[model samples]
Target: MVALDVVHASNARLRELGPGLVALFVGGTSGIGEFTLKAFVKNTISPRVYLVGRNASAADRIIEECHGLNKDGKVEFIKADVSELAEVDRVCKEIQKKEKAVNLLVQTQGNANLRGRDESPEGLDRKFTLNYYSRTRFISNLLPLLRTASTSPPNFARSVTILSAGSERAINLDDIELKHTFNGMRCANHTTTMNSLMTAEFAVKEPSITFSHTFPSVVNTGVARELPWWARGALKVLTPFFKPFFVGADETGQRQLFHATSGMYPPLKPAAGSPVAAGIPLPTGTAIATGSDGKVGSGGYLVNWNGDITGKKLVIDYQAEGVSKTIWEHTQGIFERVEKINEARA
Candidate 1:
């Protein structure tokens, strides 16, 4: 487990790099995204950050607090319903119009609900879209700029998407989307496994940029807001018993920021001569994390809540069967079909 002290120490060193970092947070309006983004602003020196979500009021409050934390940092919010692929494209276009490169792209967007199979207007499953499709859309749309950032030294190109990292189980390869056989549990497993597979693909395909899929264990966040009153009450009544395992909001921010900047998760091929220094220098006595490909220094990481990588073996056999190609092709088909449908409608 990466200690909280080490998380703080690495974050403290961020400002020393002096301000060329450009970060984009896809779900920064609230929840884990906001927490990590604020911690990032606290340590960064005048970073140009784009905050994407549908909440402008929340963005105002977050920006206000961010300015209070670091008055020089620029936090701009692009309001959009990210469940739609077209909206994801629009957000990416807006960011690309202004910035030449984006150093960090941290995605924590999701529809935390048990409503099951909520399909967006784009005809994709809403929960699946948020958890897997949209986040990948951000990474795909922004790859050019992210790759551009990686070409530079201290400014690293990293993408982090938060979902159930360790819960990757054997999914139905015939129906990767789970469109026909959808349930809450299946949705969770399918999306998490897809994230793992895609992370592996991106890591190999673009070894210069670092790719990580994380699972933030249990934090006291609005993830339960959509729960029914009875369920919410039950959780509240049982909160204290499980409180020991809960990571505090502050610590969540710190740990996530550590993931964002720490050198423990290095690229397959470092952008600069010194690969180990991709983000902050590696912490004392820690080796580079083992990637999802079952190899060290593979540039793709499936991280756990405690800021360590979880090389879950459930997907190993599928990996041997070359599942990454199917995943990438399926994902690309979704993106292409969605965009074409949107354009045709227009």
Candidate 2:
């Protein structure tokens, strides 16, 4: 496990990146998202942030705290239940009209449970919609804004999604949605895997934007407490029983903030900076990548909370198993199926 200090120092270095930065954070209402927003708002000066939440009060409080921290920065509150496509679309349109560019998009929206299968009015499963598709929909709709917001030479806008990093082992490729059968662990695994696969697919299309699907390992932000009642009780009892315990909400948030601003992670980097070397070798046994676009790291990366790249071995294993291609196409099909069904009903 990487030290928290390393992550914080890297985040400190991101302050020099620039000004007029705008970040749109969905599900920033509580837990890690809320903590990350606070850390970011504190780090950047004169920043503009949009806190998207279904609860106006919570958003307003966050805005107040941000304003309190950085008087020069401005915070806008947007209310929407992200699981709903119509709401997600509306927010994107409103954002498009107002902002020419978007520097960061953080998606931490979704419920953590397997109580029952929940589907939105769009006929898409609510759990899948929030955890996976809503982020994709938001990204697709705001592509123009993201492109505009990125720095010239076109590589600045970054999207970070908070996912369970090491939960790949529980994935069920045959039933991605877990509709036929659902257990909490199994469902979380499926959602996390889908997020990883989908993030990889989107990275290919938007080479200019950097995307990271990070698993914040066992953050004790009471995030798991948001699970259904019985599950909450079980987690409360067993979480303390586990060794190498979870990090608290504040630390988890700081690590996430590090990911949000630092270009150290995959498919995204500063257009003119180099984090790796030409001829020098490193002990991590990490591979050096050269992109045709003059960008340092242009390939998609699966990252851990400590900010050091973990799960590459597992991701490669998944790719070798032929699960990667199938997963990507399945995700696209889900999006397409939803669109067709929505149109026919309309």
Candidate 3:
């Protein structure tokens, strides 16, 4: 596990990297995303941040807080419900029009609804869409900008998705959407596995853009707000007992920032000049991380909460069985179907 002192020391170097770094945060209005956004604004020089979420009031307060921390930081809120693919596309278009490239893309948009399977208006499971499909859609739409950032002045581009990493369970290829088997635990495992596979595929396709699917461990993000009253009450009663195990929101943010900029997860081709150009020191202690392909620094990483690489045997076995490619094809098919439906409606 990487020490907190190491994470903080690395994050403090963001200011030295200079100004005009552009970052996009999905679900940044609260929880870990908000914490990371605050840390980024506090440490970076003249940072331009795009905060995307459905909460305007929260965005207002967050923007105010960010400005208070870094007077030169430019933070804009683009309101959208990320659970829908069409909405994700619209938000990406809006961002693309304003920025030439994006240096950092952090996605922590998901819910912990334990009541049961809830479907969205788009005919997809709400949690599944928010946790996997919508996040993938954002990455697909923003690839060009991320690619551009890799070669631009900042010269480094990375995407980090906060979700279950090391705890990935078996994925049923035939039941990709979990239509046949729909339980909360099963759904969580399927989405987490999909996140890891799809992220690995993306890293292979775009070696220049570092991709990481991280498990944030247990944090008091209040993600269980949609749970039933009984479950909520039980959680409330047990909060005092479980609180000690949860990581602090601010510390999680610092570790996340380290994952985004550190040399530990370097791009396929190390950019010209020292690793410091991208903001952190050269990777030390841990050997260069093994990518999804089992090679060192091939540009994809599965990280755990303590800032360590999570090389799960199941993930490796699935990739060997060609599950990653199959998952990618299945995801593309869903996106095509969604696009056709949207076009017909239009």
Q: What TM-score would each prediction reach against the true structure? A: 0.96, 0.83, 0.96
Off by over 4 Å in 2: 151-155, 170-174, 224-244, 266-296, 312-314, 320-322, 344-346
lDDT of each: 0.86, 0.70, 0.86
Model 1 lDDT per residue over 1-346, tens place: 9988888998999876667589999888998899999999999899988999988999999999999999999999999988889899889999989998898899988866668678776888988898899999999999999888877656478999887888888888788888899998888888899999998899998988889998888888877887888888898899999999988888888888888778888888886575433678888977788898889878888998888778578666668887878888999998888988899878
What's the C-alpha lDDT at position 171 in model 2? 65
The residue ranges of model 1 lying beyond 4 angstroms of the native Cα positions read: 153-155, 274-277
The worst-scoring run of ten residues by lDDT in candidate 1 lies at: 270-279
lDDT of 3 by residue, 285-318 (tens): 6556777667788888898888788857888889
TM-score-better candidate, 2 vs 3:
3
- Rate residue 273 of model 2 by lDDT: 45
Worst 10 residues of 2 by lDDT: 274-283
